[model samples]
Target: MDSTATGMRTHEIFIDGVRQVFHVAGTGPVCVAHSGGPGIAWEYLRVPSLEQRLTMVYLEPVGTGNSGRLDDPRDYRLDAYARFLHGVVEHLGAEKVFLLGHSHGGFVAQRYALDHPDRVAGLILFATSPVTGEEFWNSAMAEVARFPERHPGRPEAAGMPDAFQEALAAGTDEDYTTALRRILPLYFADYWAHEELAPMRAGLLAWIDPMRGEEPAPFDVRDALASIAIPTLAITGAHDFICGPRWSRMLHEGIPGSRLIVLPGSGHMCHLEEPEAFTLAVADFTRASVPGAR
Candidate 1:
């Protein structure tokens, strides 16, 4: 962390009586990053390469990390997260800041940008979709079924089926974390080939807030995507089984003037799997999209 800029610091603010925690590092134009999971820890989404060129604020979204949780887990929804994100951006003192969201985080980002377009300088929707229904679930399931064929001879491949089921049924923090570790390989284009990601898998942390019998409202933003007027970039990995090109293309086509980038050799975790390319795409987009950004 460079001392000349925001450097490295953890800041906490109270949003509607709930504690909101965020980590700031690197320098240059501010780009607030929201991690996915609606439950996974925020650390997994940190992009060191992009951080070098932009002041990165990694948000520990409500119900995750040191941030305060909602009394009713059912209150955890995209609109709610987007509101909390707005509070964080306001607290950062930036009238407008570039926003980057990954996976579930991308959903929140879309909602936020749509709800508060004036406060956003630019939007980066990475590895996310515009809708979630039978079509989305079916596509992912079909890909999950092919995991074994993709990683032939790997013993862990056999456990993916069970891992996917466990992840869905996980009700406790420990179980959720364990399930995430088991299914994490599926998020990468070639996890076995890259041993560097092992530490991340081992250190993975998550919290599960079950809806308690109630299902979340089906996520569908296709009809409303055209309303987003901010500069947008929809990037994803070609190999990302979940939220791959098929979904990113929809985001690109829906958001008028939005750019798209598909990392050819990566998967869901494009930032980590293809750091150099990922950093370049995001950093360049930030500079081009945000006026007066360093």
Candidate 2:
């Protein structure tokens, strides 16, 4: 399977009996992108400009899109996602590929690189953190609390907290989807000002079970981040309430010699909020990290 096999298309491959679905677009170096939410549809992570610089593999992720779901919903953890990602990379026949993960997807990327360094040419930890425990939750809520201060009298500001709580408490797919739309604007630096993104908000889909699954331990890989020797880039939107600069900086500090880029004008969804700047950073990093890739 050479690079040409990646020509704008959608491919499906079975991994451990589970069908994994992914879409291929653009040309150049192969870069596999995993969207956030553990449950969010992968479509939102697509960046057409970046596709111009690299062959983008947008994974639908098992249990999310056309892919198969696990019999036990609790099995939807980082390790499972990483395994499916590895299968996609192997099926592509790319000896080495750049892995880009956004938000929760970033967590999957980090776990993959740390577990399989030889298979990865570089890493892009976009709008994600290395840990997710009490500290992480507290810091995120703190940021949410400040939303009203930034927006002043905006009516949406009043419901932001409740919206976030609803997101966490969402018991069904429909409940989660509703909660997501209500807080979708909060993911952008200035979503209301960008009416063009309304359709994205309207079409969002997610699963409530994955997020509510039981974890043997709180997700924390800070101590192991230093072991990742491949060229790495950690980027996020400055205004990102959850995985903002503080979290990205920890990624930078923990991953030795990694590059950090904070898009000041964006929020959690930096790629959508600032595609040009996001593309430039990712494009340059991939070109430099994987020599002769283009």
Candidate 3:
């Protein structure tokens, strides 16, 4: 598999009446993974090194990005999503594929791995959590609090959680875009000083529009974690406001044979903040778990 810029192929696949857009890069054992939100497209997560090491299959779930939208919101549940992913892997004729997920995507991946452990070769969970509890939400908001002091809209944004939720519930593209623009910076405050995150920032806003008014369903994968026997890598950024190190620690403790890696001075988007370190960690973990690799 070659992860070089010129060797990738992008295409769309239809399953159960939904079209999923994906990019295939390199040529080796397959690694089929999705992005977070249950609505976010995979475009924002492009790991070139992983693509080079394995035939990376980045899938945009149904109703996201270039994929076809579904009329029923019931189809958005984690169980349905995991079944859809299984069909995708089987459709691709991959008997043993690696699974890597980021943020909310990791939640999806966790469920899928537990449901079909025999089909999975390995698991990579980057800045993901099994569940979003009150403590986690409060901690995330506290992280957001740090920036209000220097941020331009500090006064207006302070204690504006109701306003933010109202904007999201407005169910208009413009409303979603406005709220995302105002809130996204808090997720990456630690890395804003040195890195250019314009692409991720823009993509996130675009991805949030269709998801407006769609409540995030509760996901409890604690029991599933114990059932996951495959080697797993759990990576988190120390400063992650979205899903913090505590989430990663919980995953590491619950999932058997899982290792945890926390990158210093990084946030939710650790891959972007510390690409070199992130890539190296993934490459080492993947190689170690690949079938027949010593």
Every model: Cα RMSD to truth:
2.4, 2.7, 3.6
Candidate 1: deviation at residue 150, Å?
0.7
Please report, in order, the local distance difference test score of every candidate based on alpha carbons: 0.88, 0.88, 0.73
Over 1-294, each residue of candidate 2 has an lDDT whose tens digit, in order, gives 233653558888899899898888888888999988878888888898888888999999888878899988778888898999999999999989999999889989999998899999999999999999889889888888888778886888878987888888888889988998899978888888788898999998887656453357878999998898999999999999999999999999999999999999999988888888999999899998866655
* Total backbone collisions for each predicted model: 0, 0, 2
lDDT of 1 by residue, 1-294 (tens): 133453568888999999999999888888999998768899889887887888999999888889998987778777778889999998989889999999888988988888889989899999999888789989998999898899898999988977898898887888889889989999989899889999999999988755521236678889999988899999999999889999999999999999999999999999889999999999889888766756
* lDDT measured at residue 9 in model 1 versus the true structure, 0 to 100: 85
Worst ten in a row by lDDT for model 1: 209-218
Per-model TM against the reference: 0.95, 0.95, 0.85
lDDT: the better of candidates 1 and 3: 1
Name the regions of candidate 3 deviating beyond 4 angstroms. Answer: 1-6, 149-167, 203-217
Error of 2 at 215 (Å): 2.3
